[model samples]
Target: MNFINGPCGYFNMIVITSRSSSIPIVFRRQLSALTTLPLTLSQTNKNGQKHDPPSKINSPPPLGRLRASVVSPESTHFVDSYLTHSFFSDELKISAKNGFLSRGRQLHAHIVKLGYYNVLALQNQLLHVYVKCKVYYDACRLFDEMLVRNVVTWNTLICGAAHCGRSFKSNLNLGFCYFKRMLSEMVGPDCVTFTSLLHTCIELYDIEIGRQVHCFIMKFGLCRDCFVSSALVDLYAKFGLVGDARRIFDNILDRDLVSWNVMVYCYALNCLVRDAFGLFNLMRLEGIKEDDFTCTNLLNSAAIYGSCELGRQIHGLVIKLSFDLDVAVSSALVDMYAKNELIVDARKTFDGMLSRNVISWTTMIVGYGRVGDGKEAIKLIREMFRGDTGPDELTLASVLRSCGNSSSITEISQVHAYAMKDGFDAILSTANSLINAYSKSGNITMALDCFSSIANPDLVSWTSMIGAYAFNGLSIEGIELFERMLAYNMMPDPVAFLGVLSACSHGGLVYEGLHYFSLMTKIYHITPTIEHYTCLIDLLGRAGLLDEAFNLLTSMPVEPGPDVLGAFIGACKVHGNAGLAKWAAEKLFALEPSNPVNYTLMSNIYASEGCWLDVARIRKMMRDRCIYKVPGCSWTEIAGEVHTFVSSDKSHPRASEVYALSELLVRSMEEEDYVPNEDFTFDHV
Candidate 1:
């Protein structure tokens, strides 16, 4: 008789099947090892039957050149246990890699008996075993029982906790507590401790804690430590601090590719696209061979900058290096093309991917979602499932996102049900997507239900709930929700503050928006991004506080971009504040002398006040510069076909029928005294 105890360490558990004459679809362990209590390996078979000779397996060579104080006979004995432990650990890791989990567990039990009962070493290795085998409860139980707890012990358990997918906060806290205790014990942290903490902080977005760690390193004069230093650069980059991260990168004397990649990747993330290009060029001059990761980051930067020229150059580089088939690199290429608004090019890139993974599928779904191709996004999700892969939160979130913009409440609800069924409804992202979808679909009850149920809601979740309330005309509720968010220990992020500020602007809470804007940098430490400025400008402008809004635009520490300038000019036009309108117009016209919208926005201000001559002058200037609005196009997809209609497009299949229908609709609207909002029309047209 034979039995499999399975990966969970329970014995004699019924697997509910027998008839062993045929080859077992799931094989059980046939061998094991015996232990010599004082910490040594003696191999055997599962039924206590001896098999492999324990003495035949050679121990790993002794640690060479390690500090002498930490090495001795006892250490050699410990190292022996570590080696046997490593053997079992390697087996478990291999099993997980090959999806043969039960076999790995049997091997683990065999190794355990071979002199590795030290709570410290065993706890560490057992934590790793449970993590690799993905048995979270067992891992936590082992972590709890350990008499000795060091940073590594805490790190292994914390990392294991995070790996299980949803219990990050518990592990995140454990990592922090262990680190703090280690420091209090004067254990003197190394690079690994800082890296692990920074990783959790990045997830937590605990900037205050991250900065505290940064300050501690600086105080200890360990900022020059390569690993800790590299992690700091990465952390700063994550929180939108590219300049500082770059400065740190430049200061590192013994930097590696990881260090350089951290800075370059962060550079791309902050839309410092040209800087990313410059850094890449500098790396080339330094003779640092661009690896697949380098090319991937370069592609991501290129995509975000919307520079087709750079993207094509990188495409050539990938082909030159024959690295185009690399999945990570290919995924970045796909993401870049999609973000650049080149769906055809993105499709070409996707089709060229010889090996596709979840990242590849998710990127394409996001591309389709961005362009409002709901059915395509849904079809892609189905395709991924058909291949026997489960949809992760990212997959469901992307599809739910498409439904959000399409106003497809029914589809969103179905996706919501599926997400709940797949155990993703508890994840913040999937829950946030569900909230957004329900809100956009006008199911406020359902939207609020998802929001209220999210325990320990992050900034994104809080912001989503507030935004939903504000979007649906419940401004008071939105403001109150934001206040509640502030009451929590968690600090609101820039995006969250922006939502609340916009709510205040809508609700005529001028004093409140102004207060929050000031507190944003000083207290919360979120530097005022351009969007934040735009929100403030709009807030002031809406209140007919044109002068104040104008002052904000001019006095901005950062140079105002076209969007910022346009918002100010639009507000000036509304308030009939010609002084600022003229001020904004000059900047707008010079921004792109050939931009049709700028010319039109200004001309409308003139035409609205019965200034026909000015409108004509603007039109003549447009013609002179060869500037015209791109033809007005409206596209609706039906049955997977995109049907595009222009205001007077005669080239479509149903052009005549559409024209007749428009005429009839216009007549009906005229009878009801409905005035067409001519905002879509250009005077020149």
Candidate 2:
């Protein structure tokens, strides 16, 4: 039989399958050598026939690379084995590139059957294919079987362990241990090895390990490498060490685009808007082109500073560079306009986009919500559902916030149902938003149910539930839950303590409130903010301890803000403490001269004590200052639409019908002998 129909079917398989026209000329010549050579087999075939080997077989002339290994007496056979091994290695690389694990395994099986399994080069190639396909366990097994390994062998496993998409800590530890083994084996690392390890440190937020890696790079003089220095910059930037990051970035002898982007991102991450803008100007002077990432950071910085004019300039630059079509840059533009309260401009950009991701849709939805346009926000959400991209957890949370602001109970319920169907309810942010939405919709029971659904309630979870109870006036339940959270070893944060203190203030738990305050300050070492002091003062004043409340206010380290004084004034009105009420009202008036609520509360306090002259004086002061109490606005959702009503507003379409219904409710209240407090009317004085 000819070699094409040879007894060794494995060589024929390799020649037929991998002999593509696109393969290089050198490989094609080697493949031709395999088929044209007259082969002989020493082993017996399945038919129990042993073929005789040729004694004077000549080596192929084009196989000079592997010709050095042909020094053995069986030169032709050895050349065949080397050529086959080389072809298999190249094919394995292609398999790895395409992530074809099955094809890779078949090639591996062929290698083992041909008795080339112990070849170091072939084993390393197989290990690489497994790692590329993410079959890490099989890669580890193959690695353990190899008796001899090179630096490539150790580097493959190290990089694979770092990026296997497992637990962050576990992956970092695994990569670190592999590096230790590599060092113990006297295998020095290259630039690629250190770069991967630094990336793992960045992911794990282990800055200490990153520092150690930096030391190693310095010692090995690899700090001059572009990629290694860029990684070090990213590592320091993530930890907010801007000075260190800049030092490394400046030391880079050959600064590439990635190095410049890292430094710009570091400034942006730290909110140094002027510094970031300055660098962008320098980069433009250097004539280095900016990509979508660079523009996105600059847009974010402008949005944070509320520099709408600067954002417009950047928007012009985006169009000039044709980056306006990029989804990330377009999304940043929309966010900039939305945050500056230019909703119309934001809408124009959203409408002009050719394609959009979930972030694009969510940014537009949140923009409408920010401007109190919940109808438009809800409409976009429906349109998003009809498209290819659906809402993520953040999208759901933003819509939930809009619904809560409008008190749209029906919409909140619909979203909660959708969350359950789409498996987003388990996300902590979505779950917390659900709790707050239900609480704001006046459905405390539903909020409690949502809170109980969390499998692992984090700190935000417990705090949301506590605030829900406080908002609904279920203070006892809120306190019990707070205690339960403490029992579960969930350390209460400042916001958590604020929630429980508000609960105590509403429920009149003076002793418990003082104890918790002491616990927060003494045991937890949390400094009390103005809100905490306000809650404590309100709690004391409500129980008729006006002097004690004033004492605490005076003893506070920080000056009292408007909210603190307002709460104290409300408590004073409840207890008829006009003397202390006047002192606080004067301080509040000085602090906020334009706020009409402070003057109203002070006038009401005087009217209740029957001091008509003082009330008239306060009214005259308001009139002279052109101060008018802003009308309170309330909204109710009806049939999936929100209707807003200001106090005594006559602009509603059905104003006559609303007035008639209001009169009917008032007459019924009168029939039941309900009394109205005349002193409360002085708030409108």
Candidate 3:
């Protein structure tokens, strides 16, 4: 190019500089061979996977006539070199976009062979490609070899290091190091630099560094930049500093959609539904259209706080904005309705979804399970399998829970089989749910097997195993496991304590139960819940320590709830204490006036005492109050089908046969001299 005398020759004219003192010159003869290296521009990858190229590059005119018509040969050479640089730059961008690391390396070699390695812009773009492809080693090497650099060069490396996949702590540290080096070189950071750094702080969960970034933004007078302001809002919100995030959000001069969405998300994330709604309204007032992120965050917040009314209002807005078609927004709607216990509404939303992802299917299944509709959950899973999106581990776990709630052993086993077949049984969450499901299904042996299969169980595994043992009546084993968990340095939470307390109550280990209760409160500092108190009272009541149980009930830190009083009443009935039984029954009746079980319990107590008058009065009170006993029901699985039987019911198609078999069994029992204990029989309520 005539020794850099042309218009754009200043780039080649500048002296080279680098991290090291000098750049070693390689012989042109040795490098010329690389220029002939064949470059493949095929759409197929080395692994035989086909992918579209990033974009098409425009071809330049042929050089044959161009060299002949040029005013001078040197000018033609300059134009030829410019075309080559442009071509290679576009190709490098394509490789970066598609993550074609091997192709990018080849292009780099070709660029060096063409003697354009010192072109600052070309070098910067190549660095970007390296960073984009996640080849940080090569990126750093090229950066160190570069004789000239700019802000883009540092920002590329910093942003890439900040956002690298896995092993992020070290990469984030490297990013911070790069930032320091950039400052040492007297290069001031721009808004993008601060934005990336703030994001990095959030990933590191270092609020101190986040605050320092915020200060730096202000110091650099870039705080008003919408990008920087939005980043600050996100950083503070992540650290739970809602006030700080709102402050930064309020100060934005030219607020964009991103800033508004960030502010709304901040409120939603902090569980401030009112603020989130208020900000959303303000956005509308400012003529800012709400997008999918805004709706998704608000709906999720409403779901978390159980604000069904607010969630519905948000749903209306979503429909008004025609965002119901968005998969994320629709999934949030389903989640909102399901968590609020409005299963019908949840189902309607789920059925109307135009496109459903794995999340949508999982949310609907979880909702059905939460509301005790195990069969519906199972049906939905089957439907999901029929569709494109298969159930994930969460879907399996939730459906397993539903089966457990309904006590459908057959369904539970079916789901477990599915999990095993699909490799979900090894997942920690699914495995834990399987343990609980088996325990509820009265298959303690299977539950133990599931627990044992976990190679490295987490806290949830231990808690689930302990609860399984406690629920299945293996109280001693549950207690031993709790101790073993503690010996392994697993700190017990409130749920773990509940499992151990339940074990103590079931085993009738009064002293041990009381000791563990004390340990939980004093050592673990866990506040006792109603379930904990119920277990303690039941333990004392089961052992006939009525006086002590009653005193504990009265002196409970929190008010004795229905469960506590009910436990005491059962204890009184067991020991034949008519006086105290009457007192507890009266308290329970007032607390749960509509509950037929409480009235029935009191009526049975009076009848057991031979107080016919009191029994008649109790029955009359029940009738006047329109109270009736809920039918007792049980179910069993036979040949992969479930059969349910309810007391005094003849609704089944085979009712006649079932009643006849029951009568024959009763006669057989009578012939064997079996005398049924009729303790306070219930004729009618």
Off by over 4 Å in 3: 1-33, 37-225, 231-245, 266-275, 301-317, 340-345, 522-530, 577-632, 675-684
TM-score per candidate, in order?
0.66, 0.78, 0.74
Candidate 1 global TM-score: 0.66
Distance from true position, residue 456, model 3, in Å?
2.0
Off by over 4 Å in 2: 1-167, 586-594, 606-630, 678-682
How would you encode candidate 1's per-residue C-alpha lDDT over 1-685 as one tens digit per residue?
Answer: 4433322222221222235322122212421222112324333333334233355345432222111213323322222223344555555556656645566455445444433333354456656776666776666676677666666776675555434433446655666776666778776776666677777788777889988878878877788877888889989999998778978888888978887787888998898989988988998888788889889888988988888889889999999999998999888888888888888888899888888888889999999999988777887777787885677899889999998877676678778888878789999999999999888867789999999888868889999999888678677888889889888866788888888887887776788889989989898788999989988888898788998988788899988878888888777777776668768888888887888878878888777666888788877887787544787567664553557776667999888898899899989999999987763334543
For candidate 3, the lDDT comes to 0.82
Q: Model 2: per-residue lDDT, tens digit, 194-305?
A: 9888888877778999999899899889998999998899889889999999999889998877888888888988888888899889888888888889999999989988
Query: Residue 671 in candidate 2 has what lDDT?
Result: 100
Distance from true location, Cα of 54 in model 2, Å: 26
Order by lDDT, highest first: 2, 3, 1
Ranking by TM-score: 2, 3, 1
Clashing pairs in 3: 17-147
Look at candidate 1 and give me any clashing residue pairs.
39-115, 40-115
Name the best candidate (by TM-score): 2
